[model samples]
Target chain A: MSTIIPFGPQHPVLPEPLHLKITLKDEIVTDAIPMLGYVHRGLETLVSIKDLDQMVQVVERVCGICSCIHAHTYCMCVEGILGIEIPKRAEFLRIIWSELHRMHSHLLWLGLLADAFGMESLFMHCWRIRERVMDVMEATAGNRVIISINKVGGVRRDLSPDQLRWIAQVLDELERELDAIKPVLTNDYTVKKRTVGVGVLTKEQAYELGAVGPTLRGSGVAQDVRMTGYGAYKFIDFEPVVEKDGDSYARTMVRFRELYQAIDIVRQLIRKLPDGELSVKVKAAKPEGEIVCRSEQPRGELLYYVKGNGSKFLERVRIRTPTFANVPPLLAMLPGIEMADVPVVALSIDPCISCTER
Target chain B: MGFFTKLLETSRVKSPWIVHFDCGSCNGCDIEILACLTPIYDVERFGILNIGNPKHADILIVSGTVNHRNAKVLRNVYDQMPEPRAVIAIGACGTSGGIFREAYNVVGGVDKVIPVDVYVPGCPAKPEAIIDGVVLALGKLKEQRTAKDTDSLAAELHQAREFYANRADRQVVE
Candidate 1:
């Protein structure tokens, strides 16, 4: 007999509300239906209320975890429409903050994953290492989570040489600490027991369901939006970390490896820092065209479609957060797993409901 | 307060077990709530345990605004908790709906549904502010058993108790 379990609008392991209707045959999941919109704030429609310039603050709040990138993408879209040329130095600065934000996001996800699997001590250690990156962000950007540095033309703040040196030192410290914890997460008997081969999405299955970020990379797709080189990726070397096994463990490994990639990208951007004016003056312009912007968020590809009239307020602002794209794959993966592993598998996608619902 | 009630209040104020509800919040407040549990913020130093179930929770830490769908669920979670419960609204959204205030779906703040004992207002309240808010909730917990919000729900719960008592008396007479 198959029993239906309403897993969550709230669960201990989950931070946001992503409800699941799981049909179980004995200990195994027979099917799962995901329900969203517990966090549908109707933020997109607010574009008309908030002007294009003020919308950066609104977009940053779309998902606090990936706040910097959301603001960056929105600004990039506006810049694209206005055809404003941002300085080279500003691009480097944007990459520095954005990649640092990526590290914070991944570390947070790793810690949450550990917590979900009941590895309380491991969770503590992951979050502890994560704080080092947050310290750098808070020191430079003035806020730990949401770094409001991006403007339509360029970034607001410029880093001093001394500050750059401090960031480098912090990066070294972060890498050293991260290396120590990698073994426990990768080779630990317990983490493996829970994550290895838990939620297997074949490479083809992943593509068809429109999985993004680590979820897509875990299934062996070498498709990272960074490769297209928006912001600073054109100047810096970039590559997507790929693992072909396509299971929960594979997904975890993809995120872990990307941490190193993000660190490397930061290093490259720092080395190639150019001397130029921070921003170009705007001519009191409003966006008069529609444009779509795509950038790599901590989760995956975040796309924004902005339609602006000659007025200060935009006609429409539509966001397709990575979690929204990745969620359908959960249904494909959940059917065969043990009922006990549902939360772990669900979390493996690193679902951000606020991003999706917004 | 009676001797036993005072003792209960003292103990409850000392070790507050919190059940965090997300409602319709962006992940900001929720992550900071988790950060409080981590080594840096270490909210556990104050003996605040982050629990899953409402029945065991002493403090309700809500991080989001109430939307149409989850409002009832939020109220249900609050009602299920034992007396001496404290609700700490942990972000600007939880307090006044923040940036999402004017959005069609938002119903303003967490206080719109249940009485918020302490409102820690940050776009996504900082970990330090969240810790302070929880500490402030301890003061409120000392004063009352559960929230004495002037709501129909509280009156209904009170009337149900009286209705059960009267029914028992009528049964005895019959």
Candidate 2:
């Protein structure tokens, strides 16, 4: 006999509140349907009430884990609308912060994945190394974690030459730790047993369903928005990391490789950082235009559609988060997996429910 | 080690498996709790496991300010956990709704729905503070089980209800 088990909106394995209505024939998931819209905060509606400055804070709150990315996108959108040219130095700083966040976010996800597999020691190790990045963020920015350093036109804070040297030192230290983590994460038999071929999303399926970040990269798609050269990315040369396996291990590899790329991007920004004002002073005024801005968040590609109507407040703001785009791919991969692997599969895309619902 | 000594060690330190419950938080403390599990603090060395199921869990680590919509769900989760379960309320929002206290929808704190054994206390508390709070909860668990009768579950629930009712005025200032 087959049973339908509802996993989430309230369940243990889910890191986020994802309602997976799984049709199980014994222990295998024959069919899985995901139901979302739980954390939806009507951010689009709220955007109408907030001014451009306040909107930065509001948008930053969109995804707590990925707030820096959201804020950066919002700033980019607003800057595009106002036709204000940000300083070259500010652009470099943005790239540095964004990549730092990416490294930490991916490492954080890796730790959670380790924890989920019952690898307690590895979980601890990943988290311990992540703190070094957090310390770098704290020292440069007033706040340690959130690092609310992004503002309109450019960054709110500047990284001094001394600070740049400290950041370089930290990344170098992190590279050593990441080297140690790689063998345990990739070559370990236990991690291999849990992850390899656990969740399989084909290349065609990934494209059809619009998977983003490492999820798409894992499935052999070479799509990354950083390739578009937005902000300081044009100055910092790098390549979008890709893997063709389309399995849980592939997703893991994509994240691991991206961490290295993030480090490389930061190092390039530090070496090429121009000396100038970090933020361009913008007089508060209404923008009379509609602009669509897209930036790559840690999870995937995020699109922000902002409609301005000659007012300080935006007429309408629509943010299509990476998780929202990845949902279709998440559901497509679930039908053929064992019920126990559901959480690991869901997390492979780094499901950010807060971003999706908001 | 003798069986009695091993049993005593386990009892004194009921290494609780925590399952994170977010009634709806700003995600501040959620990340901080994750930080606690990371390498720097490594809450797992203390035998704390952040599990998924409420049935197998010995502790409920709830983040975020509770809202009217999720209050019933929070109570349901608390009810699902096995006996001698402890609730560690992490973050200012989880403890007293933090900045969201003034919001019309927020229910103020997790303790409004369930009895919280320890409050970590931060805008989103630091990772170190989260570790300390869990350690405190483990100690409190010893106090909870050694003296209380199994029949006091209903009574304890009643006390929690009364506390929540009185806690209405204790809401954080906007």
Candidate 3:
């Protein structure tokens, strides 16, 4: 007889509430089913009440870790409808801030992953490095997690020469600090034992199940939304980090390698910093079309679909967060593993339930 | 107070185990709560521990707006905590539902479901403010230790339930 267990809605391993009903037989899992809507606040319906400009703030709150990308995507959707091209400098600044957000978000995930595996000291060290990125965000954007710097036409905040110089210095310090902890995550005996060959999602399964971000790349797929050249990424030189193993270890390595990629992208953006106005004034013209915009978030691909009827309030606002797409892949990976390995495999997708539910 | 009671009170004040519940928060405030435990903030210096089990918890830290579904779970977790416990509602959503207040599913705030001892307000309450909120909740925990008794505890539960009932009625009227 198989024993059924409810994994969450309030489990310690999860930072957000995501319930998974796992069927187990003698410590081995038979299947896993996810139950969502715990963090749902009907944010999509708020588009009816909150105008386009105000929706930016609401969009940012959809998931705090990827707030910048959410706002950036929403703004991109609105800009697409309005048919306005943002300034080149604004594009570079947005990329800088977005990349910083990505770095901090991945660090947060890495620390959580460490804690899940009971590596307390490694968790602390990862968070310690993440705090540096948080400091830069707070100093530059005046808020740590949800910066709210993106506007429709361009960015609201501009970095001064001194601030830019300070950011570069911080980046240098971050690189040295990350190098110190990199080995423990990649080659440590305990880490490899817990993560290696666990929760493997084959490349074909990942593609069919619609896995995004590190989950897809970890399965040896070279798909990254950043490569689409939406914003300043077109000018930056980078590749999506991929690993063939498609296990928990591969997912961890994908995020770990992406940290350096984010830093490199930020460095390139700073070097190619163009001189221009921060924003073009958006007139009181109503957005009159439907547009879908996609951007890469720390978790994975973030898509925003906004519909407007020549009014201040959007008719419909639909968001497809990365975590939502990753759940099916998670369900696919859970069977045939011991119950103890559930947390390691579940967290491998960097499950952001709030983003998924919203 | 007897020796055992005095010892228990002292230990409770010295080391408070916190159980965090995320209601319907967008995750901004939830991360801030997590950040408090990190090295920079290092809330462990205050003898605070974040635990998963509610029964083992001395204080309940709730983030996000209390929505229709999570309000029941939030109350269940709050009820599971031992008596003389305190609740710290962090972030604007926890305190007053914040940006999602107008959203249909939101039940307004944490206080709508359970009594809150401290309210730390921010869009996503900063880590420093969350730490300060925990410190403030510790004081309330101490006060509850001194003031609470079996009869009064029962009375307070009734009052809390009645308070929620009345608020629900008022919301219906509005």
Candidate 4:
């Protein structure tokens, strides 16, 4: 006889309001089902009410952690529909901010992961470092969480040369701080004991379950939406980090490695920074097509589908957030595991319920 | 009241154990709440702990707009907290439903279900503002220092008696 238990929609460990139904006999899991829509804000349905210009702000709030990339994806989609190339400088600026968002998000996830695993000191240290990343974003984009920089044709804000230097200096300091924390994170006994060999998703399983981003990368799959070359990715070059073990530790390692890669990408974009217009004047003529756009968010690939009918209002706006795509694999990975490790396993994919529901 | 009860009241004010509940928030306000516990804002300096269980918590700090799915859960969590408790609504979304007010499923502000003690206004309610709101809840906890159980019970008894008296008056008029 299996006893089914409900785990969330509100739990202490993960910030997202995801509900997981775990079926268990004694203490071992039999199966798990996730019930989402707890935090669904219905932004996609608002496309009819909110015009194309005002929709950028709505899209950014889909998930605050990946807000920049959400706006970047929307801008890219809108830009695609309009068939106008954004200035090279704007693309560089977009990716610079996107990379900063990635670093901050990774550090945030690391801190939360530490907190979840009962490593309180490590959690505090990670958040302390994350503050510096938020500081850089706050100084440049005017807000720490949302950033609100991306627009349809270009971007809302531009960083000065002094701001660029400041960001590099701050990120370098963050890299050094990460250097200090890496050894303990990777080799710590408590972390490894809880994470190693836990929730293994093989490469084939990942693909079958539709896993994306670091979840797919952790399973030895080298597929990242960033490789598709959207935004400034067409200019900067970096390899998607991957680990073959496909367990919780491997996923953590993948994010940990990608944090450094994010810094490197920002540095490259800064070096290759171009001089051009901040934005192109957009025509009032409504776009008349359907377009699908994808960007690699901190969690994974965020896909946006926008349909237009030559009006200021869009026909439909749909978002396929990374966490939504990764939920299937989360279900596949939960069977026959110990009940104590449920939260850790659930968090491995970094479930963003609001993004998922929206 | 005995010395132990007084001591318990004092301790409750000294260290308010706050439980955070996210109804349908955008993760903005929820993260800001977590950020306050970090080294940057570090509300722990005031002896406040972010507890996991509601029964042990003296304050319920809720963020985000309430949708139909989470209204009962919010009330259930609010009910679990030991009284002489307070609720702080963080973010504009929680306070007034913000941008999600017109969403089909959302039930608007949290006040629609439970009484909110404090409302911290902002899109996400910055960590500084959230810290201020929590600190303010601490102040309320101290203000209601004497009413641990008996006073609230007495108030409820009075309301019940008043209901009967009003019914009797109505009968007389009929």
Candidate 5:
């Protein structure tokens, strides 16, 4: 006679105000518990009334699908607290708009995990190829979806060789319409009977509940903060896409192999296209201390910190994000699942619950 | 049985579903309403769907800009959807409360709380105008299943507050 439901701070396949609580016994889940301060948006008290250029639009409004990795990690923590340089063609157009906002946020989390298992044609073929990478990030950053195109001392949009040969001919029509929906989403036998080996998450419970992205690369850690090279992911070159099982179809084959490793790092960032000046001016003044940057967002490792202190404003800012380190590995993969696989194992850890209640 | 209820009404007319709901802007129409459902505007060949409870939706989109702390969770997600539901709303900050129209923590649009039917404006409303506002909310869900007495969420919120108080008393008569 366990009982105790509570689902969310509001409930109905959730709309943020998280609250979990679970403990069923009848419907199965015997334990679950979560609760976060429903959108505690004081956002570290607007870093003392904004300044590092309006605190880069309050760290790209925390997370509209990782707002360009929180304005490119608050311009890499105010260019590592004002040392500023960044310009190898605005760090490869901020790694082609942060891997085209990580292949449109892992095809908008595989079309909300195919509209949460009800599949509706693989959720309209993964949001119709994430609208050709949100129309190549709204025709090269003029805002089609917060393409504020990260700025401070770099990136605010450039790519022209006729927009990198129309983004390599829309990456060969988005790799032939993402290879005609990868056999209805990775060999569809009803998406492998609703994500095979369901929600498991192990590699020592994803490194003791700190799983991030592809649910910590589907539990086998080949961790990926773009191999910590930050912007222009240290002159392109890829790999980190791992998968060791830890179930939910190996975190849906590690986000379908990081969407072919973000379409092969945007085809090697449009074949190493680098000319000059994407943006580099920064002189808005008022910045003094603390840094901490980090990137890899698209549901993982976002970090930010910031601090500064001279005048125009900011004196403290903090953001952790990647769903706040993937909520203690989504409450350790929600106690042996069941109650209708607890919202597809809490949407296989793609719970950006507006980037963990901002 | 009416041809197997006309093949379960042609597979629920290609599968409508949908549910969404942000109702407090600045997530940019919640990432163009999850990029109009993902592989780049694949409105599921018109069988559009995003369902996540709301009594198995048939569309109810609503993005954001309504405030006073999410207007009672946007009128409890339009009273937990179900009946011949439709809604839509979308952006230009869920239509009207754009740039947080003089924010004091906004409460502007989302049709002041519910009764929408299809707006899909912009400042974050593209994904092919959210697949032309979900194919004009599935053609106003075929004129709301042939209207047999409809308006009720408290008589459509007292006919949208007496049509916005007679358009604010017809702008106090020109």
Candidate 6:
């Protein structure tokens, strides 16, 4: 005989409200089903009321952790519709800010993942390193989390030479700090015990279920949206980070390795910083076509579909967030695991419920 | 006040255990709330804990706008907490629904479902600002404690009167 249990809407383990109905035979889970829409605000429907220019701010709030990428992708979509080629310097600036956002976002996830398995000290240490990233964002872009730096044509703010130098110095410090925690996060006995071989989604399963970001990369799939030469990415040397193990530990390592990759990308972009206008003046231009743009968020792939009908207001705005894509793989990984391991395995995908529901 | 009451009041101010509920926020404010617990802000120094259980919580720290579905869940959480509790609504969404006020499913601010004692206003309120809001909520919690003590006494007297009146009616029937 099997028993059914409801896990969350409000659970201590979950940061956001995601209810999962689990069918358990004794201590082992047999089936799991996710119920969403708790945090749904119908953000896509707001395009009717908010104009194209104003939608930048609206889209930024879609997911706070990857807010920069949302606005970056949205602006790219609008720019595509308008056929506007932003300045070289503006593209590099977007890269720098978005990479910083990636670093901070990865660190935040690492901390939460540690917290999931009851490693309180590790959680604290991970967040402590993340504060420096937030400090750099505030110093350069003004706000901490939701920095509205991206406009349709280009970026809104320019980093001064002094600020760029200071960021380089801070990145050096952050690199050193991250190195200190590397051994504990990767090689520690307890961390490995909890995460290793916990939620194994093979390459085939990941591909079939549409897993994106680290979830797919962890399963030995060498797929990343950044592989497509978009924006300033064409000018830089980049590779998608991948691991052969299809388990929770591999996913953790994927994000941890991406932290270093983000730092390297930011440093390269800063050294090759071009001199040009920050943004081009668009003289009363209204987007007249449908355009779809995709970018790699901290979690995974973020796709934005924007439709304009020769008007200020966009006809339709649809966002496909990474967490939404990763949910199927999450449900697939849950069954056959012990009930106690549910939180660690569930969090392994780095489920951002707000992004999923939004 | 007795010695025990004084101790209770002092402990209430000394350590305010908080339960945070995300009512459809973009997570900017939620991260800021979590940042308060980290080393840099280290709100634990002030004896505050983000204990996720509502039953043990003395203060409810709510972030995000209340939506159609989660409004019931928010109210249920608030009801579970012991009396003489305080509620702090963080961010512009939690305060007045901010940019998403016009969204079809959004029910505006946290105050739409539960009584909010402190409102920390920001697109995503800073960790320092969230800490300040918690300090303010503690003050409100202390006042509520005193008010509850007096209110409980009046409730006890009314219960005694009702019991005696019921007994007198039974005697007349006999």
Candidate 5 residue spans exceeding 4 A from truth: A3-20, A28-33, A37-69, A72-99, A102-104, A111-149, A153-163, A192-277, A280-282, A285-310, A315-337, A343-345, B1-174
RMSD of 4: 5.5
Query: Best candidate, DockQ-wise?
Result: 6
Across residues A252-285, which tens digit of lDDT does each residue of candidate 4 receive?
9999999999999999988899999999989784
Docking tier of model 3: it is: medium
Q: Score the docking of each candidate (DockQ).
A: 0.71, 0.24, 0.64, 0.55, 0.12, 0.79
User: For residues A10-90, what per-residue lDDT tens digits would candidate 5 score against the true structure?
Assistant: 555554556688888877886887865444344557566555666676567556666777887888788878788877888
Residue B37 miss distance in model 6 (angstroms): 0.4
Superposed model 2: Cα runs more than 4 Å off: B1-17, B44-49, B55-59, B67-69, B82-88, B95-112, B115-123, B132-174
On residues B1-174, what C-alpha lDDT tens digit does candidate 3 reach at each position? 468778988999899999999988888888888888989999999899999999989999999998888887888898899887899998899999899999898889899999999999998899999989998999999988677765775787799999998896677553
DockQ ranking from best candidate downward: 6, 1, 3, 4, 2, 5
- Superior by TM-score: candidate 4 or candidate 6: 6
Top of the candidates by TM-score? 6
Fnat scores for every prediction:
0.76, 0.28, 0.86, 0.60, 0.33, 0.86
Clashing pairs in 6: none
List, residue by residue over A1-358, the lDDT tens digit for candidate 3: 9999999899897888989999999999999998888999999999999888899999999999989999999999999999999999999999999999999999999999999999989888988999999999999999988999999999999999999999999999999999999889868998999999999999999999999999999999999999999989999999889999999999999999999999999999999999999988898859898988999999899898889999888899999999999999999999999999999999999999889988
After superposition, the stretches of candidate 6 with alpha carbons farther than 4 Å from their true spots are B149-151, B154-174
State, as a TM-score between 0 and 1, how close model 3 is to the true structure: 0.95
Instruction: Flag the better candidate by TM-score, 3 or 6.
Output: 6
Quality of candidate 2's docking, in CAPRI categories? acceptable
- In Å, residue A107's CA in model 1 sits off its true spot by 0.4
Ranking by lDDT: 6, 3, 1, 4, 2, 5
**Which of the two candidates, 2 or 5, achieves a greater TM-score against the reference?**
2
Candidate 2 collision pairs: A12-B52, A40-A357, A127-B38, A127-B39, A128-B39, A128-B40
iRMS of each prediction = 0.9, 3.1, 0.8, 1.2, 8.8, 0.7
Prediction RMSDs, each to the true structure = 3.4, 8.3, 7.2, 5.5, 22.7, 3.2
* Native-structure RMSD, model 6: 3.2
